[model samples]
Target: MTRPKREPRRPKTVWLDDDQQRAWRQLLALVMELPAALESDLQRTTGLTTFEYLVLANLSEADDRTLRMSELAARANSSLSRLSHVVRRLSDNGLVIKSVCADDGRVSVVELTKAGMRRVATAAPLHVAKVRELVVEPLTKAELIGLGRAAEAITDRIADSG
Candidate 1:
């Protein structure tokens, strides 16, 4: 008689040690809380989510306030589907527009509208203030530099792995 197949055992979750746990929790809190705080400020002032702000910010810095959809998705660190949803919202809000790429008919390009520029300009100061209040104000100058370096290193590692 043929034997039935057995399922593979699940790997155990590795719980962090005390020191590691503390740092991990801190990082987790920062990742979750900071964005919520920033989003609150953005919503209160400009009626935009943090994601919307990122999209507008990316377009604002792009050549002629425009970028191909794929590039924008990479820069925003979001999936194409998520980017599409946000872009549709922004388009509906008159903050951005989408068009067929000139160089590649199959590709799409997203551009910031003048209204988006004005809105982002208005939101910039508020967003900066909130960031300063939550993250920067708590760190020393040296700590700030270290934090930036650490973030860059993490980003580089992710890019390398990708």
Candidate 2:
């Protein structure tokens, strides 16, 4: 006689316990509020949105103050289309220049103009002050290190999955 067929196994659902739930809620609040706070400060002080500042800052740090459009998008944590729009605006404002790469005619590159560097230089101190006030000052050194490790782990997991 043949044995009966085994049913497919269902995946286990791991629900958060009360303490875990509380911690998750706290994290959720930070995730929602932190970016808004940073954006507000940056916008008010620098007339640049957080994303725009990120794009400018990345270019400022890059070799020759230039980066490929795709690389800049990844560094800025933005989509290519979004970066294209932002670059267009920056180009219009004379803060950045986009051109075909000399080495690779097919690829586009963005260069931070002297004006772009000046913009970031003016903005960096204010952004750093806001970051210190909102994030660093409140945390003890140990807590700050732990937070960095946790962020790294989460980012690594996300990158791996994606």
- lDDT string, candidate 2, 5-80, tens digits: 9999999999999999998999999999999999999999999999999999999999999999999998988899
Worst 10 residues of 2 by lDDT: 73-82
Q: List runs of model 1 lying over 4 Å from the truth.
A: 1-15, 158-162
Best by TM-score: 2
Q: What pairs collide in candidate 1?
A: none
lDDT of 1 by residue, 8-85 (tens): 999999988999999979888988988888888889987889999999999999999999999999999999999999
lDDT of 2 at 142: 100
Count of clashes, each model: 0, 0
